[model samples]
Every structure is written in C-alpha cells, then in structure tokens.
Target: MSYRFVTPIPKRAATGSVAAVYSASARELGALFAPHLSPAPDLHAALWAVLRESMLAGTAPRARKEAVAAAVAVVNRCPFCVDAHAAMLHATGSHDTADAITRGEAPDPLVAWARSTRSAAPDPWPFPAAHVPEYVGTALANHFINRMVDALRPGSLLPGGVLRAPSRRAAGLALARTVRRTITPGESLALLEPGAGPAPAWAGDGPVATAWPAFERAARAGGALLGPTARAAVLEAVAGWRGEHPELGGWPGSVLGAVPEDERPGARLALLAALAPYRLTESAVAAWRSSVGPRGDAELVRVLGFGAFTAVSRLADRVAVVA
Candidate 1:
C-alpha cells in the first residue's frame, strides 16, 4: 500500500523533459504517480512520446479509444487506470457510459468488443473490421501498462468517485490536451538495440506484425534510456535470469538470469520486468529506488513497463499463432 516501494526522485533530481511531465502529472494525477515517472527519465520520453501519439494517432475517436482503455483497465483490475481512462471517456461526453463502467454497470459496445478478444471462440466483431489494428494495439498496450501498474507500484490519483466526477473528468481532458502537445512519436522503430529480441515468430505476418516493428522499437528504446551504469546492471540481471521461476505469468524459462553483482536495483527491476512481475514486492521496489542505485524513475518505469509490455503482448502473438 505504501508508495515507498519505489522511491520518487526529487524534482531537482529528475532529468530534463521527464521533470516537465512529472510536474504535469502531479498537477493532474496528484503526486501519487510521480515515482513511476521519475526513475527512468530517458525511457519516459521515448516510450511515452510514441504511445501518446498512438493514442490519437489513427482515426480512432476519443470515445472508442477511451472505451478500449477503460475495458483493458477493468480486465486487468487496475483501479487507477480504470478511473483515469473512464474520466477521459466521460470528458468526451460518454458520462453515463464511464460512470456505469467504473461502478460495474451497463457495459458499452466497445467494452464487449474488448472482452471478446479474450474469447477462445470469437464472434463476428461488431465494430469496423478495418480498425482492428488500432483497437487491438491500444488494448494490448494497456495490457502491458496495466500489468506494470498493478505489479510494480501502488496508489492512484483519487480515493473513489472523485476520479470519475464530472469536474475531475474535465480536468483529465484538460490535462490530456496539455500533455498531448509535449509528446512526439520519436524514432521508436529504427533498428534493434543490442540486447533486444526481434519480434517473435508468434506475432506472424499480419496487421499486428506490420505494426509490431514500431512497438518493438518503442519497447526496446526504453532500455536505451537507462544510463550506462544502470543499463549495464539491468542487462546483467536479465542475462543472468535462469527463467526457472514463474511469477505473475511465466516467461521463456530458457532465457534469463544474465546480470552480475553490484546488486543494482535496475538489474533486479529488469529481471522482474523480463521474467516475473507478480514477484515484485515493496522491498524490491525500495531497493531499486535506493539512493545508491539507479538515478532516475522514468528510465526504470520504461524498462519495467517494456518488460511487462512484451510479456503481456506475447499472449496476443501466441493466440495469433494458434488461430
């Protein structure tokens, strides 16, 4: 329950643009979400820039976009994410919809569609079949982000209905308006980094795979944000990963446990990101945030988020392969 699990960097200590977003997030979501943003400054900028752009990137309306996001949050049972996106949905004038959703009431069409993706036997999807890539991408992205939130951190912006309130929802819209200008889809998909694995075979040669390059770049780019020291530590931990233990959901057991001593918090964080998120504990969070360890929070979040992102998205890939 304690935010102390991950230590927040002081405003002065937070790096360049990450400091800017931290200030904005504090203004919008309260100080609660700061720790998630402050550690991995570089990753914060690169990953989010592309993701935020993607949120409004294609023709997806804010309504459908937020609906997909809210549904994903509900599916993941991430209280914070559900409220945040539901508010965004409300601000778009889907008041009854958002309110009902957060309270666990009338389900939206998009919500049903989002749920259908999980079905072993999917029905004819009712929405625009052409929007599949964008819709599925948003849902999958939230799948990754949700796991990271539920796993690595704690706390939300508001206590309860406050987050879903009309005024609060308007504020969320305002924040989105402001925050949107700051984000830029960076060169997320340039070329593979040293330690990054290419898009897995399960992704297949389909719409998701076509777009997979960008996501893969964005996912791997966050790891690049880690400073030389922290980056090395994390890579070491991932390399040392024995992959024997299965936590949250297990990852490829044959590939992990590659880090060394120095006990760099980033290394532990990376290992958890790659292999076991359910294994994340307050003690582990605190150790990474330790003064002696890595310097930034955004970098940490990006690396950790990317790890969870890759893990969760693997479900879609495997499902695609089966189909």
Candidate 2:
C-alpha cells in the first residue's frame, strides 16, 4: 500500500534489524503495520515487541483482546485499524462479534469498556484483575496504531480501497492460521536494549510490563526534533484534553500560537495527531515539510507518532489508576 508520509520499507529491501523484525512480525501477525513503521526502524521493532508480548503471548483469551482492539479503533475513528482488527477478531473465531464490531457496535462489556477508554474511566474496573496487562496493552497498541494508520496510510486495507463484508471475511480467513498460532512472550524484546524503567503498577511482571516502556522510549525519540517550547506546548495541550474528541476548528491552529513561527508547523501536526487526528489537513503537513530543510519521512513520522503515542500512554495511565 502507498503511504502518505513515509515510503514503507518493502520486505525484499529490508535489511539488518528491520529485516529480522519484518520476518518475525509477518510470520506472527501480518505486514500491515510493520511496513508503515519501517522508516523508523527502532520504533518499528519496539512496537512489534509490545504487540507480541501483550496480545500474542498472553494466556488471557486473545479473542477478547482482539475485540478490545477493534472497539478502540472504532472510538478513535481509524477505519484502517477497525477493519484490520475486526478481521483478526474474526480469525479468533468470534465471527458474530467481529461482524458487530465492524458495524460500530460494542458486542460485549469488554468491548464497551474499550470503546469508552478515551472518554470515560471504568469505575469498578471490569474483567479479572489478572487480565489487566493484556487488555490494557491491546488497547494501547491499537490507540497508537490507529493514529499512525490514520496519519500515514489509507483508510482501507486492500487494494482499490475495498473493505466490504466479503473482502473482510476473506481477510479474516487468511489471518486465521497466524492469529491462532502460539507465540512465546518476550521474543521481540531481543530487538531492543534492556531499560531500567520499572513496569507500571497496572502491568505485573509480565512481558508487556517490559515491552511498553521500550515502545514508549523509542516513540519519544521523535520529540528530539521538536523544540523544547514546542514539545511543552503539545504536552500541555494534551493535558488539558478531557478525553472527549476535540471538535474540528481553530483550536488546533490556535493552540500552537505560543509556538515560534518556525516551529508551529511541527507542533501543530503533533497536537492534532495526539488529540484530534481526524482534523489533520493536507496544508498542515505541507507546512511542516516546507519548513524542514532536510528532515524527511522518518522525522515526520517520528514527530506525529510521538504525539499520538503520548496521548494514549497518558490514557493508559488513567486506566491504571482507575483499575
């Protein structure tokens, strides 16, 4: 698939760490997300590591987490992920549930909770406390993926922008074998250097506990491209968000008023990706590119991806506190 911001590293062209991660990820999941991430190789590996540990390796039923992924995609308005994960949810043998999710319906309590993750906290905490790591990880993964896909890829997964029922069902059938395959935890961690951050209180000692910090660290590297003032502006804006989706308007434009004229483009792009991605515009990206002399696709993806992930990470922290 052609991407908007970055050229995907084709499988045949992948080398070194990117090659290893692409091979393992394709064998385990599929090629959709990893290719889009290949421009930033460490971010690619770190995210795959998080998904492997949280979704693929968990003892909790993968089907439930798949459901959560789809539901979160729905809330985020990321059609690419909603369709992709709905197919994966179908591969888990929850055919009716997957179909319902594709129609924008929450088929169960777990899915309902996932849908509400951005807007509302779960009061009494649902599900077995033991399943927190897997569930939260899955939601966080989709939250990040949804924003990236929205910013980078087309809304549909297949060629010609097709995403009808028949095509979705066929995609599910193709993924069934891999979705049902057994995977070992922490396998993808080999791609990352070990870090010292302790697991968050919500994630016990599971592989996800380690994987999330790694993903966050790699993602945060994008902030290096942002001026300190720009970075602080984006974070402060995200902090003021009430979890409700922001209405499209002058706010994304005005929020960056404090940013220097030269830095506003990048800062604006980051803020939109984090709080209101659907509001992103062609002019917004063009502005950033016009200002950046030599910083190309990798830098663009980093700046936007960092913003998106930071928002979701904060949401995960909120979920942890409520739980």
Task: Give me the candidate number with maximum TM-score.
Answer: 2
**Global CA lDDT of candidate 1, please?**
0.54
In candidate 1, position 258 carries an lDDT of 44
Q: Against the true structure, candidate 2 has what lDDT?
A: 0.81
TM-scores for all candidates: the values are 0.59, 0.94
Tell me the whole-model lDDT of each prediction, alpha carbons only.
0.54, 0.81
For residues 1-323, could you state the per-residue lDDT of candidate 1 as single tens digits?
34434566666777665566556445433332335544655444433433443454555575777777777676556776786777677667677777777666537566776654444433344456455555666766666666666665644645554434655477566655433333222233232123333444433333334345555665666665444555655454444433233444433222323433344455556556654555666676676567345555555566676665545444454333332
Candidate 1 weakest lDDT stretch, 10 residues: 183-192
How well does candidate 2 score on lDDT at residue 239? 81
Quote the RMSD, in angstroms, for model 1.
7.7
- Stretches of model 2 off by over 4 angstroms after superposition: 158-163
Query: How far out, in Å, is residue 23 in model 2?
Result: 0.7
How does candidate 2 fare on TM-score? 0.94
